[model samples]
Target: MDVVAFKQFINDQIQLFAEKLGDAKHSSNDGVSLGKLTFYLAVRQSIDKKASEQDMGLVGAFNDTLQALGMVEPGKTFMSKLDT
Candidate 1:
């Protein structure tokens, strides 16, 4: 999908999750944790040598959403490698 479509899909997914989790702050904590887990899994999948382009796309999409939401700094994502 194109960038716009991908972004829209991500936004929709986020909203859906939020709605399903309800407005209760305490209940939403689990949703946040689930999101983090999903992100880490995507990151790990992206780094796998056997990963397909689709896997990397998912990682990129997740990173894009994070950056868009200001949850991450520009050009810095879980996929970024630290300088040794």
Candidate 2:
């Protein structure tokens, strides 16, 4: 787990997102609603795709720690076991 590399990756993502944000068309405050939603989804999808390709070892380690502490159960999705 190279901390420097991880930081660089996140910084790169932030810069890219910021550039997209600046380029987003906002002719008027009322006209930006759809554009904002589209940009938000694009950023979210981009981050998810990039993250899936990276080997961030800490993410696995953190999940394992949570499982060991019984904070997370195996083979169960959070959405499937709602408190309500």
Q: Which has the greatest TM-score? A: 1
Clashing pairs in 1: none
Runs in model 1 lying further than 4 Å from the true structure: 1-41, 79-84
Tell me the tens digit of each residue's lDDT in model 2 across 1-84.
344454455556655555555664533443344444443444334434543322233344445676778777975422223333
TM-score attained by model 2: 0.31
Misplaced by over 4 Å in model 2 are 25-84
Clashes of 2: 0
Identify the candidate with maximal lDDT: 1
Residue 6, candidate 1: Cα error in Å is 26
Cα RMSD (angstroms) for every candidate in the order listed: 12.1, 13.7
- Clash pairs (backbone) in predicted model 2: none
Report the Cα lDDT for candidate 1: 0.61
Model 1 TM-score on a 0 to 1 scale: 0.40
